[model samples]
Target: MSCFEILDPAFGRFVLGNAALKQLATGFDWVEGPVWFGDAGCLLFSDIPNDKILRYTPGVGISTYRAPSNYSNGHTRDRQGRLVSCEHGTRRVTRTELDGSITVIADSYQGKSLNSPNDVVVKSDGSIWFTDPHYGIGSNYEGFAADQELPCNVYRIDPDGTIEAVLTDFNCPNGLAFSPDETLLYVADTGRMYQDDPAHIRRFSMESGRPKSLGIFHTIAPGKGDGIRCDMDGNLWSSAGDGVHCIAPDGHLMGKILVPEKVSNICFGGRAKHQLYITATTSLYAITLNRVGAQTP
Candidate 1:
């Protein structure tokens, strides 16, 4: 089978003709949250069901980074180079301090506990945005099953330590990422959790500190978008049932890099951020890309 399905000719520029998707590691229960640490020359990802965070080094292979990670799902580095995480077990967004202590950013809004924090992204101004869905709390696999006290909403934690609900209309918002220039924010709404069909991703324009849904960004044909990241050119690479779907800045289909297993999340790492690391169902995959990923900072 072809390794990629390029919808537009422009998609050809981001991929290599001889680059094949390689499974870096496997045998985990559920793998997600792949983040590259260029400074450490390693990659860290979560195996949610196993409650572990695994690390992969260049010469070395996979090793347990942290066990009992509190079911960390999504991860990204902040402006200060701290790891920001969305924890399902704790139902909160946390920042991994330089000394490795966990600092709670948000747990409850208006005295009501959050449902489950899924994905997170740090903005340029040090504000944190994350999706709080019931995915982690809905079952006993990822986290302890519990009642959802708050509705599934996309929230923003200001630099001043104030929490605000930016958008409260999603059924279960999943992955989220900002555009290369921070002009737009894309969020995935996996309707499967609500038994809804035709799962789609939405793009919101950030002009006045308020986000308004511009419209549907892109719709996956046979799968749903789970985790998404943007390349330097504002091309969004989102996790699909088949693999990762690359969407253009104009919300047009770019192409897909097929993975053997269903992918959950992805991030750009490696020296120049040209390597794409993916977290699939039970494995971790990576491939070198001709184009580099958009810098979150």
Candidate 2:
């Protein structure tokens, strides 16, 4: 029952062996994105099919942060502490300013509408990065269906409002994150669509603040993974069909945290930033861990 046996080697010194998973809330169609707001002391996550964003805290329980959330899929905070979100319904990326107004980041490129904005992350330089897939347009359940007019690609919205395609050739890019040092970028390709053999997570070498080389990082043996994040030590914590998998920075399979439901996304928050908040399908769960997430970089 040692904590080291339950978490990645990088996290062995952090999570207690006996820490128990705590259920926070339930009753949603599907939960996907999760972002922690330390300033507000709450965790915000998406219930995609429900078209809503929900907030959870230790005392107040669950509350609707935003209804009709444009079927948002993924979310993160900019360095300025603004909420940035990826919208499936609109096939665009947006930001919520402090003054409570929405600014569309990217809805189209080269006069073509994006397929679906799935997951998002922001860099220290105010560049917005996101994944575009066809999940939103594959059916009418999560958003309006339409012919996909764009390739499944990763895009970067520069600080000056210029949009640039960062990566392409992905079949289904679902989740993404940067290594603690920002030298490597990891993205999950659920690949549930084409390509009989799909990659779970792919790593790209970053040069001059851009991705220059691409390689397969790790592929889950059975099911798929999504919404990956890194710890202070560079271990990737990814959501899986079974639960959560922690892979070492050296591509070693570390350990896992088991949950009753399929987890879609996760974030670190709480008093010491040691709390791991998980957005499982239809439910939200958390557990105290021994490590802290990598600060946005």
Candidate 3:
């Protein structure tokens, strides 16, 4: 049985035949928000229902990075190499400073409490962008069930501490990433909870730090995309029900990486950034590829 499912001939050059998908860890209710810390040689991810953050090292195995993590769901590193996280329990975005202190990034917009912050990404200019959906507060499984105070929207926090809602038309914005050159922003909308809503990824053109919508980029079938990342070649790797779907820059489905569990999120990590780390329902998986992830810190 082959793990690779080549849908397009172009995907052949991106995968390595010698590479195998390895399950790094398991025994979690749900896992998401994987971020690679190259400086520390570790990968930190959230076990949402468990309310803990787990760290994985190549040889050391899995360990608890942080417990009672406020139900964090997504994470990324800032330009300073600090950890930026989206917390579902607290319904806010936060940053873990180098000195071991936690700083609140954003919790509200225009005096109204925000929904749960799902996924986040940092720009080269130090801006923090994230998606706020009601998923976290909609149930007691992943977070404290509560009423949503604001609409699901995407927001950006400026380096100087000002926060603004950047996009407001998503049914539920889940994952997000930037192109290698930072010219394009790809965001996943997993609003399948509502009948008739299509599960898709939307592309936005970035201009002077603002996004101009380019409409639906691609739609995922067999399940929806919850998290997404981009490789150096501008190919977007998205977490799907069947596994992981690779979409080209022109919005074409290139291929799929089959996994035993449904993938929730992914990040490019490992020494040379040639490895793709995936967070699925109950396990963490990784596979080496011929491509390098887009440079982001």
Candidate 4:
């Protein structure tokens, strides 16, 4: 009964073979984003179809952080420890201020409405990066059903409040993360969700405000790449239909942590930032790992 499926020797050393996988909570409708707040001693995740954000504290169990969450999908914390989120129902990105107020990061570009903000990450420099896809608008289950008005792409919100489409040619951008030093960006395209499209992750070098594409990093088959994160050693951890896949810094599949449900997102948290929190269909699960995320708690 190993907790991990080690596909590479390096990954065997990366994950504890005996560390048990724990299900923290259940009974949610489609959990997608999971972010750990070490300062608050709790983990926050979205139950998208329910349009709510649930907080899971070790002793207190699960509670509502925010109801009517605008169908938030992805979340991350800025360097200042503020909450940055992507709202699928609202088709916009938002930031929760210290005073508990919400600031709109971006909802439109060039006078055109965004499709739906999906996954997001914050750079050390305070710039906000997020994916825009039509998944939310494709139906009324997770969001208000409406017509899409923009291409499926990834965007960057500048520190000064300017918004620009950094990657414009995605079939369906779903997940994104930065390399350990912020020199490289990894974005996943789950085009396979439709018409046998390529389900792969792409790499880019961040330069000149418009990053240069390094090319496809890895092509996933029989599954698709969803929410993703980078470890301190620069390995990319991605969500798949089967479980969580760990790919090497050089784009080789290293290993996987198999979950019973389809995994949507992942984050590194817990007291030591060595806990890998996973968001699956209707549950939140965690396992202790020997690695740390690129961003610290």
Clashes of each: 1, 2, 0, 0
Clashing pairs in 4: none
Candidate 4 lDDT, tens digit per residue, 14-103?
888678899989998899889999999999999999999999998889999999999999999999899998998889999999999999
Candidate 1: tens digits of C-alpha lDDT, residues 243-288: 9999888888889899888889999999999999999999999999
What lDDT score belongs to each candidate, Candidate 1 first?
0.89, 0.85, 0.92, 0.90
TM-score of predicted model 1?
0.97
The list of candidate 3 runs beyond 4 A from truth reads 192-196
A best-first ranking of the candidates according to their lDDT comes to: 3, 4, 1, 2
Best by TM-score: 3
Q: Tell me how far the alpha carbon of residue 53 in candidate 4 is from the true structure, in angstroms, after superposition.
A: 0.5
Error of 4 at 66 (Å): 0.2
Error of 2 at 30 (Å): 0.1
Clashing pairs in 2: 14-290, 15-290
| Weakest lDDT window of 10 consecutive positions for candidate 3 | 191-200
TM-score of each: 0.97, 0.95, 0.98, 0.97
Whole-model lDDT, model 3: 0.92
Instruction: Write one digit per residue (lDDT tens) for candidate 2, span 89-157.
Output: 998999999999999989999999999899998887888889998989988888898998888998989
